[model samples]
Target chain A: MQATESVIYNRAGQRVVSPEYLLFEAPRTKHFMTGSEAVKEAVRRASVDASVSYPITPQSEAAHLIGELWVEGYVGVYFRGESEFGVMSEIAGCAMAGARTITTTSGPGTLRAFENFPMWAGTRIPVQLVLMARGVNSPLSIQPDNLEVGFLLDTGCMIWYAENAQDLFDMILAGFVVAEQPDVHVPVITVVDGFFVSHTREAIMLPPDDIALPPYNPYRAPMPVIDAEVPPGRFLRDPFVMKSNYISYATHASWQWEVRSAIERSRPYAKRYLKGLIEEFGDPSAELVFVACGTAAAQAKEAVRLLEDEGIKARVVKLKTIRPFPVEELKGAVKNAKYIFVPEFNVVGWLEREVRRYLYGHSDAEVIGSPRVAGGMTMPAEVIVQEVLKLTGKEVKHVL
Target chain B: MMRKRVNIRMPALGGQGAVTAAHIIATAADYEGYYAVSNPFFGAEKRMAPAESYARIGLEPIFDRGEVVYPDVIMVFHPQVITMGKSYTMPFYSGIKRKGLIIINTEEDLLTDEDKERLESLDVKVLNFPATKLAIDIAGTELSTNMAMIGALFGAIGCVGLDAIEEGIKSRFLKKFVASGGTASLDSALERKFKKKLELIEKNLNTAKGAYDLAQRWAGEQGLEPFLPPPPKKVTV
Candidate 1:
């Protein structure tokens, strides 16, 4: 059977709808799917111009599905690259050449492709990297652990964390729009906890396949597109390593600062397109709060329900945007909290550090990095509840 | 009172189709208008290796993700998952809730006396049936074993109707579905054996029907109530 009977027409013939129209206004039908499948559905409607692929566990199926999209003519140009480094570079070239480019990688693959991220941002190429965060190798692991995201925190790419398949679908479609804005044009790395999302099947609402997001307009880029239209900018044309002058050092430093600024500028567009940079769940005035992202947020939301059952007031401030940290939205979300818990899949508790760093002067709540799971371990909500109980000096009522 | 939410865990050997079963059960539940979620164990699966998967169906949206540490039901698709200690969780019934159900696919009882005592204290019921035998007998292939397991699950639960199960099966096989690389290849192998795709689907459906009937009878004999409330009735204006 054809992979998608719904993909009836070439992308060229598809009617291009606005991102808002595609996301909010279009009629939707609920379908059961895994996170990887959700990626294919998103790419099908994304009006993507190019995609590069490399095989990595948890992300391989999603990458394969995108290649299927290419074969079916939804994606204009698609090919498999030699490695994650090669794949990342290929996508950067596609974006620099004025193609709306996308790609997928995980764990070691993400780390392998690390150099291109900052370069893509420095080049101001609006490529979308769907990073399926998995465990990095020391002793190798293929299971879901998001430690790699910590490594990419300073990569100058606008980072988004999707809690599950549905969030992934919406973020990818909106990711392109927000990342491609003239003022905010930079690489967008949408991270979902590998396997937890990449392999898990759940229900998500999808817009009809006949419509698609408006195609990328390379002419609108703040930087010149390297399509031989206008002569490529001098800085883009030459490698900065050739010049050993003080101006080159200043140029590199200022350009890195501008890349960071571009990420900050994405906040308004991201807040508007993604609906909010953070999502609040559970009691609005909850004193016990959790600041989390990706699957940790999922576990925390479940913990909220279990806490409710125990007559505990708890809430979750799920951070959707990680690089352009939702500082203001988070402050508002946790204003009433006396104790804030940050649950994370990585051992570093990078999210906890971010929450602590941002809320230093804003809130007096004691920030605790509790119930951290690493090395591909699964964090059940019960673990979170037990942690809360122990921290509160209450009797532990649940364990798993 | 019926459960508003039910979490089911299936620990089976790889290639046994527990992952596919989990997907179809969740799909069937979704078709019945209930919120459902499913996932496989995060591991590199190989044939005969312990491969676990989970499915949660509920009246409310299921926010819980990753492994189902505490399951309302446990379905053991192969006796090796019990006899050979081939399971991710110990005793093949770890973290099962009180008054839950376990359906095993062997005709012979595989649980140790200690296992029986623990389950009894928890008020859990164990249903031992030859699901693979049913698959071989009805579908003329052992590959339909997961189909029998799916039937037995819904049959004992008595929540999702057969129509929804058929729809789930149809969507899985007839329509373009993505689960895993191994699953897709196994599907092609089954189709080649059956000669036609429609015939393959029909035989698989019959296998599920046969097992469902057997499970229904067993549940009736044990005076088991439906574990979950029936899917909320369709609202028609």
Candidate 2:
């Protein structure tokens, strides 16, 4: 069966269109566009309340597209911030006003926004941020890599990866849904590989304008709405007051615990909203399973196909929804496999590290991962097929 | 029981419009109602660097992404791509499938006699089409040679209809022309090419058709059979 693009379909296998933009024509079922263009279209359909952003390569096109839509009055709030730090700050304020704000950044921009990453969870604000993955900072090459994503892993936010432009369109909608839930009010990071996905053009079947995603509905009335007289959460007790009473210390400590637990509770919501954390193909009982996320996942799928013709069977378990880690889903998919081969484009190999952390249950299935495709090197199916041949104790000289 | 998916890899130098040529082919196939995925793989340098773009055309939704390593067809945009090589420094023939077709856009074949004999022994079909020469002859400027290459690809592959490619070329170029209001768009067209709006379109179309005819004639002379869809099998139920 063909891998389908429609996320929501009916019994007849036809896409179930939502009754929104019955008049708009932008989301024509299948339009050949770049991933950046698709994200722009998705954001227009999302009807965001605000998008305060600092321009950066790979991601700037998306931000610009959304800005154009906003300027033409198809979208809601839009702003140009001086820096990534200011952009994140705007997101926090707009989100507090119950605005469905969104933004995107890459490479050095991610570093600029580092301080505000944890603050999104601290304030329980659910902002949808797209990290078009890039190597964070110095040497200043504008190529695709996931090093920036590695830094944000511990920043108290839910993360997801998109394999292509179509997935980029779908993930944004799903991300907002999970982030806005009453029980899970943490922000979501929907990542796409810079240049690889952003610049590449392909056909993406977006929901028709009328059937576009519904606007984000915040969990409750936002704090400190002067119009409604709703009060913001009090910060009356200082840390010095904690010296006066242990109970006060516990109350302040609960804030940190609440954010962590909130993200943990978002796991089921992620599975529900974003479908399974993985999209698996090939044989589960094969000697090896190619585990990957983002652009590498797409490359792995192609490699698996090449290997199949050579009488070497393999499975592909693509990590889609990246956090709350998706350990169980990956564990289940790679259960019968003896090895997991992960290829990433960052020197850190964070994707492989994350896999090893979760693949502990399957003691027999060893995780073999490396920064196989790093820098500006686009990972080819030949490289992956070569890796699989090495594992089977076959001659690596020329077979693959 | 799935139809074969075709992977085509094209390598070109910077500023050669190689990436655009790849897009045209993929877009033409897509316009013909097939699923086509195209992407360009380039390094940090903007110009004068060797680059490669790829395309995967199939009847099904193609989940595959990145460069087409195991290419069914290899189209070299310039003979220099073989001579100059890539920025990351990899050989051109590193991932080409055996017994596949190689179409290079040059007047004379770049392959040495030994390499030609070696490739022939492997059943690989290698052809040299004077794409840029035809473009300069038909379109006055060599800039639209990419269009000529697309025409040659359609005539050579025959997987996608030549009519679809012609239509694809028109729609892609006409996007800006139509968007800015037809002949009133002549300012930029004239500024860039010293040609009127309609004249620019006419030249590109003629150049593409000219290349297509030459490539089709070569294919016919070589006794190469055009790709045809398989007949539907009877269902047992």
- Cα-based TM-score, every candidate: 0.95, 0.84
Candidate 1 backbone collisions, by pair: none
lDDT string for model 1 (A1-400, tens) is 1233454333557776768888998888888899999999999999999999999998999999998888678998999999999999999889988999999999999989888888888889899999999999998999889999998999889999999999999999999999999999989999999999998888898998878888898999988888888754453532377656667778888888888999999999999999999999999988999999999999999899988888898999999999899999998888888999999999898988889899999998989999899998888888899999999787766545
Candidate 2 CAPRI classification by DockQ: acceptable
Model 1 CA lDDT for position A78: 95
B224 Cα displacement, candidate 1 (Å): 1.1
lDDT of 1 by residue, B62-140 (tens): 8887888889999999999988999989878989998899999998988889999999999999999899999999999
Which runs of model 1 end up more than 4 angstroms from their true locations?
Answer: A1-11, A232-239, A244-246, A398-400, B177-195, B233-237
lDDT of model 1 at residue B227?
Answer: 79
Docking class of 1: medium
In the range A1-400, model 2's lDDT, one tens digit per residue, is: 1244746633222333432231223344667878888888777666577888788887887888877767656567887898999999888888877777799998889998889988887677789999888765567777787888888887878888999998898888777777877778888999989878887778877655534455555536222322243444553312234456556757658877877788888888777666677888886678788888888888888777777877778888888876788778877787687777888888888888888887776657878884276665678777877777777676665543
Q: Which prediction has the highest DockQ against the true structure?
A: 1
